[model samples]
Target chain A: MTSTDTTTAGKETSKPTPQMEGTTKEFYDFCQKKELRFQCCSNCKQWRHVPRLMCAECGSWEWQWLRSSGRGKVFTWTVVERPMHPDFVEDVPYAPVVIELEEGVRMVSWLSNCDPHEITRGMPVEVEFDAVSEQLTLPKFKRRNNPL
Target chain B: MSALQNEACIVGIGQTPFLRGTDDDCSSSLRVELQACEAAIKDAGLSNKDIDGILPFYGLSIAEDLAVNLGVRDLAYQATSHVGGAGPGASVANAANAVVAGLANYVIIPGGWYGYSGRRVRQIVVQDVNAMSGGKTARDFYFPFGLTAPVQWFSFIARLHMMEFGTKPEHLGAVAVAQRKHAQLNPNALLRDKPLDMAGYLASPMISDPYRMFDCSLEADGGCAFVVTTKERARDLAQTPINILGIAQGQPFPADDILTREDPFHLGVTDAAPRAFGMAGIEAKDVDFAEIYDPFTFQVIQQLEEIGFCERGSGGDFVADGGIELGGKLPVNTHGGLLSEAHVLGMNHYIEAVQQLRGNAGERQVKDAEIGIVTGFGDFGDGAIAVLGR
Candidate 1:
């Protein structure tokens, strides 16, 4: 034995168990093609975020889901040496990044594509969606053109 | 409330010495709670057993256990708010609401106990245990790595802010330095003197990433309490009475934290302060001093902008101009605050706010401060804000 405890535990989703609450089947289908989508509010003509059913601006229920530009900027990020949850133990000191897209929406995703030691404020990043499980794929981010 | 808006006030405050450890049992912590309760009662010149209701928020564990052990005679009402540290302001609001609704008069809102002093209690959080065992999160992401505490979680915020806003180590020290300087004048503070500079802060042992020992609030086993009554009774009881002007709480829109740019700098404050300000009917600039809850150093800067003390993103400059120090345009955390004084469940901020409003805060008192604002934020994105007036 190589002294490794267990490698093949046979699981689907990664830690944090990415489960969809308000996400739709259409959006899920769109994700299969590796495309990110946001909802466009009908009344205020603005894009809705976190994939909500109604418009935050006009409180309109009308929304049309469409593919995104897959681009954003780092707003704020933190190198989490401590796991907010215990399931994140395997990824011990992960970079839990907060990125603000130019389109004015903010999200929390992992930071990849650069040395965590080299990360700085306002670093530009792009979407890098990868399949973490058979039924689900997480949309994480990485530094633009800079792979560590 | 509309007719008597901005008229409610917090009249009294008190706390017990925050030690590093305690061998005390439930009844012992209850004794400390009673001590704080008595102090606030005396501070307000009221009777100890006069409280009609009890609001306990400092969950060394939870409410029922402490309430039962406290021997609170004639306890007509009881309540416990969510958001842990955010409970003080929330509890005060609960007390004020009880008074306003005539459910009972003279409610006692006491936030007590310790978060880390768990030797006697292993914290029987069945739900959290079940969730962790289900192999969903946290454990796989953090436990095996030993990222096991609240300070560690908050360190991530500081690291991210640095990566996004260029917030240097000095900015964190600037806040700590000011808080320590204030603590020097406060006899009740925990770490008086023991100065910390940017260099020293950078060298301090990392609790997690950017958070050093100094970057985090010094939490000792402490207790604090306040008494809420009608504004008229407050005037008749003490020479100086602090009134509860407003109280507010709020939550974010709930986004996929992993998929969006969640601004930790602009936190629950933005959603919370508006309600307090609206209730108080005063703009943020009019306030002479703010006794905001500072569990972490970065929280102050985030709060200042969100509370409308300055424009958004200018909180750094607001601090740069000495707006938050002693004798500045607007003093903050005058009673050493949670940073230097003690992490006494954010109820101490209410104590300081009441003291400032009543002009009784000894050497750390703000000059002629008639209005004081205090806020509390903790545990999974929750917060509460309250306004007090003389």
Candidate 2:
């Protein structure tokens, strides 16, 4: 599912904009289309995150974008009380969770609709897309209804 | 022992007054860098012409600029360490290679910055995200989630450590308290006059969960430098040389991404420590003291485990019982460390190791200290380690 709340996203102009280039840009482009995907080696069947140009396991350059299960558990999390950027000043006390996806890769994302104090390790989560800006769509996580 | 063992020695160490603030005109990083370098050269009883090599902390100082400004007659070799704060510690290994290989006679590693007065570290990182060693991932993944600061990034690891090993906040406080106690005896420490206790540490403001204001390192305006030369050359210098027994640097499998690593607790130091100790023909127990990079209080605990001071995941308990205090089993951060001392990008840690080895550390000196280990933890857990002996 993708969000169309442009008004809320547009106000966060001061937030750091991702430098869209190479494999990194390709990963974000997939998010823009409301699909959570990671780079998988076509030859060795290895999955990697943040999109890489080559596979580290077998030293292969053949890879393709594969859809993620969007289901994972919180590997860890931190509640940032102070705002490092001015844009996040109003968003103080936010929790950023590191999610270990079912695909055996990890990514840093926000835990949507969860209080900072309630986050725990191994808490199950599922991904949802947010159209943060015209050029960006971020994949955020929410508590899974059935945490198997 | 390796050929490099006891071959290179730190002959001189120098630093600028660690200040919380500086005058507008005095905030030139290059100026302070040059000042520290001159002091080091003079301390070594050597002229600018004697300095034939330079290993600068990349992005903070440049070798070519420092060489010209110091008036080096023959700049034979130059290199920069790109491992963030690990640059200084890793530079020792690089300098040792240069001196042992006869590529240069004397190498100076200088690091300085206006971390507090001028563009703060956060400002610099956010200004140019791509310039950071792993900025691409930070820009694309971390920044969007409001994970912008080092404290925030490291907090996740700390939280996980706490969850898995039951590391208490008091354990973290023990580190802050112990280091602050050490700082009390260090006149050069910025927090020398300020005392921190377990109570005071718990009362400090929380910038990030599990990391209080006191848990973080000082962002100050200062600089530190040291001169590295062969052990043979060190005997003729102005000061007693602290032999460089062994040094090594390493990075995590995915050096750029901390979350994706196989073991979140495994850092660059985990890999570098063994190699360093092996080169020195010593083990962890042979270490008389340690000067770990303490960007945050938890890092001290983490590095202590990685560097083999104590058992893995037992660091919290290790520091809980005055274990890392001056009179404890293994004194750590004898110069107060980055936790209380000014952060000169970890060059100060290296300088402290040299002082302890030279038996020049006045009040905080580790008595009968003969061997010491110094470490640097840099961008995304990159690590460097050096074994020093008198």
Candidate 3:
């Protein structure tokens, strides 16, 4: 397990890390390489996220990982005023957004550049890789100048 | 009509006192569950040996242990519903099916937890997001972004509704205010004495954007249970039977991921309402009241639209102007709901629905309420609906 510790006002807090196992491990492995990818069914050419073994549409076990354009729009968002976890206490009032990618898949990520109050539905955004720890890379998003 | 329709009815209901603090007498989850179960069984005028089936909320308690403690023998039907808060209401449908199918003569559905005294809901979700069905995605994708709680997850939908339909913060406040008013009539409500107005609701501190502390349901330590038996047998029971007119459970198309859904505003109730109404041979207009599973204030509005109580995008308006309050067009959450009442994972909704149908709700009862709707929502919009009539 990889852990990151931050000290705020002399108190230490540990950031939560996802367990890298099963299909989840593969997706994070790609992220570690700075390549954001989702599973695409080789049989039906349908895209799926959160890394699954089989395609929900065609029910075929045959699939392969494909790179995403990482371009999308903010479908919706929320600004957390109260952090549920102690690690995020310093980041209170942070915004998490659901970005609907150009490929039609959606994922939860944070806005790396935009203010939480400035975020609007359908606002254009593109993914930016962040290496938070030695073994993990998260795909965060930034505001896009223009829609593609 | 389905064979299960109107075949089974809820005969008895029981619950532990809704409390923000722990009761040393009933410390463990199972102990509270057993207390509720014994009360329900006795309420039904039946003995432990008479209960042949059990439907428990998933991961809360096991049927074998519940049955063993209750001294229930010859347990025939046993299953668990994994739909989070929807488990209790969905279990009603499951229990009705079991009794109608002759798999069991009487079934007990129970839900309980130490939400306040022990680990809170956020602690449980943080410990294991995968505990939820189809929640693996939440762990890998959502949790890392600091989107850990239901308030955060549902806030996305709430914000989208606001953007799409002109829903305002005041609209959400209406739900909180109305439920708090009803809670004043409920002696068991955790927030019964804490009356709230629109101004008070707006003044509450924001936990998540668009959702203040008032918008959230109370975290309570308690348990609730209800008994289900065939309608023919219900006539001999101690209480007036609340017939299960219709019941249906559904999931959003994606089931796991909320953002990827074709319609961001659509919920499992969108798919379930029609089928449940169809089974009951009724329409939304026929419901005198609604016992919606209200974990959050915005959820009540979302479910109102999806359950066909009002047009989509009009729930905000429908809830305003005393719409869901007592003596309104549709009195909702008459027992204060999960919002003002304690959250027993929506089991209290079932108990409240039964009380209303039986004309037992004293001060908060909707006059002449012969039929009502009870709904459950959980796990990224998985929903269940049960129509009960006297």
* Candidate 2 CAPRI assessment class: medium
Stretches of candidate 2 exceeding 4 Å from the true structure: A1-12, B24-28
Q: Which order, best to worst by lDDT?
A: 3, 2, 1
- TM-score on alpha carbons, each prediction: 0.76, 0.97, 0.96
Model 1 DockQ vs. reference: 0.19
Q: What is the lDDT of residue B134 in candidate 2?
A: 84
Task: Kindly indicate the candidate among 2 and 3 with the higher TM-score.
Answer: 2
Q: lDDT tens digits, residues B55-120, model 2?
A: 988787678788778888699999987789898888899899999999999999999988888887
State how far residue B127 of model 1 sits from its true place (Å): 7.8
Best by TM-score: 2
lDDT of 2 by residue, A1-148 (tens): 0122334434636577677778878888999999999999999999998678788999999998999999999999888888877778989889888999999999999988789889878889999998878888899999986776
Q: What digit string (tens of lDDT, one per residue) describes model 3 on residues B201-262? A: 99999998988999999998899999999999998989888899999999997888887888
lDDT per residue (tens digit) for residues B123-233 in model 1: 222114321221222222222223334555456666655555566777777677778778888888877757655577678765556766777777667788888877766
Task: Considering the two chains of model 3, state its CAPRI-style docking category.
Answer: medium
lDDT tens digits, residues A1-148, model 1? 0112222235532243333334644554566578777678877878755566777678999887766776777765456554444456567566666566666665556676766567776788888776654544456777886532
Native contacts, share recovered per candidate: 0.27, 0.85, 0.72
lDDT per residue for candidate 3 within A8-109, as digits (tens), equals: 344543666777898888888998898989999999999888677788898999988999998999988999999887768989889989998989989999
Q: Is candidate 1 or candidate 2 better by lDDT?
A: 2
